[model samples]
Target: MMYISRRERFSAAHKLWNYEFSDEKNIEIYDKCANANFHGHNYELIVTLRGEIDKSTGYVFDLKKLSEILNQRVINKLDHKNLNLDVDFLKDLIPTAENIAFAIWNEIEAELKTANCQLHKIKLIETENNFVEYYGQMQS
Candidate 1:
């Protein structure tokens, strides 16, 4: 088996909200992030795939297929959109980089099944200082 990876980028905005808390309480808890005004990030996404390379192509997976899947599913939905208001997943869940990473992983995983590939990991970089990773396994 061989592993292959691809990277892409998009910009989006979101806010964190907790329903259990009062509007004012959530605002105080999340501060700027809780603001209705929202904030944006230039997100970098890395997707890794693992599978046996095809003998004819000598590749674990086709880069064009991977890029197309990402562009069609992830980048199209997320790029230049307001995550909190525009994305169904983020409508309830906080749009933190961590949650966003998991959502992206789920989206890509669904597409990968049809392509005969396994998703290895998803890395989301919210900024130079903040990043998150989802490897699709429970840590012992």
Candidate 2:
């Protein structure tokens, strides 16, 4: 099997909200992350796919297809938007780097299936200091 990866970037903002906690409690627990005013991150995303190269094309998967899928599923929804106010998925879930990475993996997984490829992993860098990785496998 061969592995290939593509990278993309976007900027967005969000605040973590937990309905189970009072606004005050949420603020105390999440600190700046609970700010109603929101905070932004210049997010960098890396998507990896693994599969056997098609002998006819000499490629594991078509780069054009990957670019189109990433653009349609991730870039369009996240670029220059506020995750707290603009994305439906974040309406109910925290928009932390981990959650965002998982969401991206889920979104792109379906699209990749159509091309006979698997969404292997997503690495999301929320900042130079913080990032998350989602590999579509359960670790023991």
Candidate 3:
């Protein structure tokens, strides 16, 4: 089996505070990330797909097709937007990099089925110091 990965980027804003927490507690736990004004990041995402190469196409999955999916389904919604407010999938969900990475996985998992490839992994980089990687729940 072979795995192909795509890199994409978006800029978005979010605040890490939970409304259920007291203001002081939110500040204590989330530090400056809980700021009422929110904050933005140049988020980097790496999406990987796993499958055997098609005999006819000689590709595990086409990069052009994957790019379209990432652009239309993910980037168009996330780029230059507010993750806490502007993203529909994230409504009432925290916009931390971990959550965002999972959300992106969920958003695109079904679509990838058409190409006979599995959504293999997601690596989300929120900053130079912070990133998260999630391998899907199974492997083949």
The TM-score values for the models, in the order shown, are 0.88, 0.90, 0.95
Q: How would you order the candidates by TM-score, starting with the best?
A: 3, 2, 1
Clashing pairs in 1: none
Write the residue-wise lDDT of candidate 1 on 1-140 in tens digits: 67788999999988888778999999888888887788888999999888887777787788999999999989989999999779765557778888898888877787786354688889899999989988986769
Off by over 4 Å in 1: 114-116
Alpha-carbon shift of residue 138 in model 1 (angstroms): 3.4
Q: CA lDDT, every prediction? A: 0.85, 0.84, 0.90
- Top candidate (lDDT): 3
For 1-140, candidate 2 gives per-residue lDDT tens digits of 67899999999988888889898899888899888788888989999998877778888788887988899888989999999779765556778887888878877787786344677889999889888889976869
Q: Model 2 — which ten-residue stretch has the worst lDDT?
A: 110-119
CA deviation > 4 Å runs, candidate 2: 114-116, 137-140
Over 12-91, each residue of candidate 3 has an lDDT whose tens digit, in order, gives 99999788989999999999999899999999999999998898999888999999999999999999998988999888
Clashes of each: 0, 0, 0
How many pairs in model 2 have backbone atoms within 3 A of each other, for residues 3 or more apart or on separate chains, i.e. clashes?
0
Best by TM-score: 3
